[model samples]
Target: MTTTLTRPGALAASGHPLVRPQAARHLTDEQIAELGVELDAIRDDILAKRGATDAAYIRRVIKVQRGLEFAGRGALLFGRNKAAWIAGTTMLSFAKILENMEIGHNVLHGQWDWMRDPDIHSTTWEWDFVTPARSWQHTHNDLHHRWTNVVGKDRDVGYNLLRMDADQPWKPFNLGNPLYNAMLAPVFEWGIALYDLELPEYNEGLKSKADLKRDLKAVGIKAVKQFTKDYAATPAVAMLTGSGKQALYGTLVANAVRNVWAHAVIFCGHFPDGTDTFTEENVEGETRGDWYVRQMIGSANISGSKLMHLMTGNLSHQVEHHCFPDLPSNRYAEVAVRVREICLRYGLPYTTGPLPKQVASTWAKVFKLALPGKGHFRKGKPASA
Candidate 1:
């Protein structure tokens, strides 16, 4: 949750405060309006270009994913050679990652809404993940975006597992073994499914029993379909062709690869050094510009080549993505340059680094924050409802 280089009170060398002071009180109206205008210009420019090229890009990515998936599964089902199986599984893994990231995540974010394709829109496009699209949209798009890294508000802080912040009360089980973090990456989707259920909230009387039952039924139906597709039906079909074992193993490997990659990329975005977390008091009366500032500070960027960007769903520009979630993701890179300039203009922190550095710094925070310590940025008392 906090940044690198241990200092008693400072977050980074800049010593920038984690959450901006209450923006309405600290910022001049003119300054806030200037930021709003600059960001809007960037969004407007990207919006104007979201036509043929963008459409072609999404359609092409989907086509490649489909082709790879078919070829991969075909090899797994019909081929007996071990090398063929490995190739098939690798292809399948890439296919799943592309589907989940470039296709599923963006489409469900309404990134392609300008296409006017009803089927591909956020309202109807479900994902391959066990968490139902509607539920995920509510939790992720609505809640997570609305409360990026506000410790008590965003359920994503440590995902209700590890203690991400020093202020978060440490329970006996808070001291999880490193293996616990390791195990989570491969089965990240399952962890998300359980988190989405909000069962713990239901138990704590935060969510009603009736709503819990409804959400549970929805999750159960989606989980059944996902499990059957990867674990049962494909293997069964391959068994009829005498390649059942290979098919099953291939599917398992593919799923694990997809899950771990997604987990790693997502963790890199939020938990790394330089990213900030807020308290309820700081966000009170937050304006549009204030929200943008919060997101900018709370998200970190991973720098890499275009292929790495594609693999990360262009979340390498996490700050830009958080700023403009509904924009065609391809435009994030273009807008990122403008965003960084805006940060410099406003004297805001621009936090970014290579993917390896980002990931290592994030995991180090995960390990360091796991044990007891004075929580970073714990001064603001949580605002009342």
Candidate 2:
């Protein structure tokens, strides 16, 4: 059976807030209650601010994304012009990133539910991803955000391929994970598309073959639509105009850039050095306050400028986002300040660092955990590995 406890005592006080020791340890019930109340206040304040301003923000972002996409595709028709190819691919990449992160992710999270706009609502909005939005919402929003870092419950830990936690049984196959992780970056969406089918469940007899087949069909449909748009039709148009080869190459490159960047931003959120993973038992009888505390310790955040935050779809505030997944995306930065103050008052570790450092740390973790003798050993406590 999997262990059911959180080993907070294992953490050591690193200088960075990202690795501050024992952020969640030794909190009395009273303290947990107090923190919970304060957190609710922060959530409520952000909720209240979700009005015309938030609506306008999302609309404007969508407008910008559409414009960039149009211009990028138009420029790509100039195909063989090296400068146009470079500029168009870059613009397309940025457009894809904005659509996936700011628009698709947040919108599908129901962050814009208050607007009551069906066109933009989670129910109606499909993204450029190969994974159907319904499947993604279920796996990501319902499962991932709900479970956060609980070892057995959250498939997101290493995403069913990498052994993220050292305690996970290591096999010789894992030795190639460094390479696997690297390759995964450029094709991350494809990996996720396959994963969203939950094939493991069907193999384990937890899900039926019929259900898996249906899901696979859905994925195939989405994949065909995506590929036709990006790979076939767009380039075919250019080809007819004598720029086919360049458009094809440019779109492929742009997709690679968007995929890898998204992978990096997402990996930096959960797998970085200071982030904690929990045993399923740790959440037994968990309260809302306990859930909030779990999210705080289990997720790490990226520290960066406003543009960086926007580019990341404000997922730079991953901790804040996990804490209130349904909250308006734009409000996370504001809530983060209040959250840090609460963390200070309650002596919680508010883990955050610059983007480069965080991404590097996460990669270091991937490499280290791949070899897998043990994970970071904490002082005086049983090694989590």
Worst 10 residues of 1 by lDDT: 1-10
Report the lDDT tens digits of candidate 2 across residue range 1-385. Answer: 1012232322223222221124465677677767777888887888876788888899999999999999999889887898989888999999999999988998888888778898889888999777999888878987788778877889998888997777667888888788989999999999999889998888899999888888989998999999999999889889877899999999999899989989998998888877777765466555567678878878889998999999998999999988887788889998899888877888777789999999888888778877859777221122242
TM-scores of all candidate predictions against the true structure: 0.90, 0.92
TM-score quality measure for candidate 2: 0.92
Q: What is the model-wide C-alpha lDDT for candidate 1?
A: 0.80
- Pairs that collide in candidate 1 are none
Q: What is the model-wide C-alpha lDDT for candidate 2?
A: 0.81
- The true-versus-predicted C-alpha distance at residue 88 of model 2, in Å, is 0.8
Number of the top candidate by TM-score?
2
The residue-by-residue lDDT of candidate 1 on 1-385, one tens digit each, is 1011111122233434334443223457578668877887888888987899999899999899889999888888864678889888999999999999888989988899889888678888888888988878877887788788887889888888877776677776877825677889999988888888887688889999899889999999998999898889888888888989999999999999999999989999988877777786566556567677777878889998999999889988999988888898888988999999988878777789998898898788777776777545332333331
Worst 10 residues of 2 by lDDT: 1-10
Query: What do the candidate models score in CA lDDT, each in turn?
Result: 0.80, 0.81
Q: How big is the RMSD of model 2?
A: 6.2
